[model samples]
Target: MAPVISSLNPNHGPPTGGTAVTINGSGFTGVTSVKFGIVAVASFTLVSDSQITTTAPAGTGSVALTVTSPLGTSNGVTYTYSVGPVITGLSPASGSTSGGNTVTISGSGFTGASSVHFGTASASFTVVSDTQITATAPGGTGSVPVTVTTSVATSSNVTYTYVNSTAPVITGLNPNQGPTSGGNTVTISGTGLSGTSSVLFGSHSATITAITSTQITVTAPGGAAQPVSVTVTTSAGTSNALPYFYITAPTIAGLIPTTGPGGGGNAVTIFGSSLALTSAVHFGSAAATNITVNSDSQITATAPPNVGTVLVTATTPGGTSTVGLGDAYYIYVAAPVINSLIPATGSVSGGDDVLISGSNFTYIDAVFFGTAPASFAAVSDTQVVATSPAGAVGPVIVTVHSSGGTSNGATFQYQL
Candidate 1:
């Protein structure tokens, strides 16, 4: 099938030729030749299957332009040779009173434009081609007639209105802190952000995901672990900047009382840096509750009911703490219990080693011999060795304590 020529960018240029033009259409791949009215284009470059670029060849009056490919020859479009600069239209015919916004003036015969004037004031301008010139509106007030000047002739006048417009104002940024490795979405709340041209974090540009008159969402770029200025730019000007922080990922140096009961509800202190914004703490797949951040290096959260061993991690806006960086492992065990006491009796003067057998005694914290406390050693999950403390010659109730809870009471006798 033959390629198609939709339209030409300039349609017109100097009779002497050498005007840059972009051919827009479809099926442009493998284009073999191009011609400006049978004169044959000097050279042409195929940009894509839908576009082509080439210099307009020297021609007189109106001529047909076409592209040829191995499939077939394309239809021709009329291309004209310009005699002088002409102004057909202006984009954003209005700008701020203080000026400095780029305005595009579009028309044919723009080749060799020497200057652009807003009323009597000369404005800086760049000729993009025979059809477009971009001018930075000079400071002015009220409406002014803008015209383009070339050696051959001055283009027709077009009205450019000047009025004061407020620069954007930023009120806040949600989740303003994120991992230094970046790739986090941050929402910006502000005013006058319509038609925003760019959003910058510090000096780096962020990819805008969405935008509106009062809010914008952007994918943050990678940055250092420090504070940076976040700002937005639009036609009016750059907005007021808000502070953003780039934080490194949180770490877990250690988890105090690394083991607890499967029933849960125990305070566990997490120690590490970059934890000031900790939002969640997890033990295995279960989330902890009542999390309180003590500082940048510490947080306390009630362990949730979970069984077996699991990696404990703290998550913040900065990032989640990874395992292998610290003591991030936790185990859940059953409560220690005292099934029976050996000899069950000890001297009132206080030193007697007793054998305490029970279920779940692996993490015994302490043992009670009646009203007095006793020193104890856990030999296994179900046994403990304890020395009775001095007391009056009488019987006392004995118990065991562990991460689970206090165990059922067992009888222990004291004698004279």
Candidate 2:
């Protein structure tokens, strides 16, 4: 009961043989041969004992077939000879699905390979000889057809093609602005910005490392106070916000006088432009006897007394500039103490006619003996009528001209 071959006639032939096959079965007795693999079929004829009559030889496709019995052997079925699998080549037709692709498939029968498909994906093959086969491509979408499935009995339509590779695209982000405590180092152009997975300034996700394709280096995420929009993410999607901006540092706009004269020298002229960084120009709270930061919008302070209107500020690093225009400047009367003046002497070449009395010559505007040019004729605002044009006389200083001021010196005499 070891004989089974229910039909086989010209099923397919060609490997070097004419054709004339006929073999139906059911316990063929003592027939000792009929094999289409290992090639051998030169006109067989048993005719009964179940039946056997063949004529086909020459090999390439369709095999794993057998029939040789004395009472044993006849279980491998399939015999279609005429060669069919022939694909030519395929080594890296494109890949990405996280599939770790490593393809290499040449053509012709690929010996003993039972499966290797890339279209519906079921790959993991290896048959490196007889025409190469080293596959690992399973996660397809665009192009597919690199197949090789064999169980022997030959069957081939021959095919190999699979491609799907796309990863890159992002666009815009230059100064987008930021400041909520965020550091700010943003530059993200676009178009597949090289492997950048994240960089957002609006939703708050920054700290992206440097990457390129158009450039992407990010560090901005504190909470966003003003400027927004800036996004970039890759794997293939997300990029189109681009706008960053944030500014809040430079303020102090009103303080012209606010208060002056307390022993705090008093020359106060802080107009405000960050006041050029005036550290202490306080007058109502005390501490501004002398502070001079002349530019950035002027500051010449000298006033500290605990006054009635206090508030004139200027601080930098981008943070304080207050000048609310309160106004204060007045503490006069201490102008008239020309202590002593007797006879000192004067004479350089011009006749010395001198007599200067001192006390507090008010508002005087003309008198000089050392720099020569004194021809005063006032005498009654503390006295004056000085005529000493070319002077070099030792201790000489007599200046007095009135209107309620000018005369902190007097002592003259020159006769040569």
Which portions of model 1 show Cα errors greater than 4 Å? 1-99, 102-164, 261-266, 277-280, 284-295, 301-305, 343-353, 388-395, 413-416
Per-candidate local distance difference test: 0.88, 0.60
TM-score of 1: 0.61
Off by over 4 Å in 2: 1-4, 7-24, 35-78, 82-84, 89-92, 100-114, 117-136, 139-147, 152-166, 172-416
For candidate 1, lDDT tens digit of each residue in 258-296? 998889998999898888888899998899999999999
Ten-residue region with minimum lDDT total, candidate 2: 328-337
Q: What's model 2's overall lDDT?
A: 0.60
Which pairs clash inside model 1?
none
- TM-score of candidate 2 versus the correct structure, residues matched by position: 0.23
Cα RMSD (angstroms) for every candidate in the order listed: 12.9, 19.8
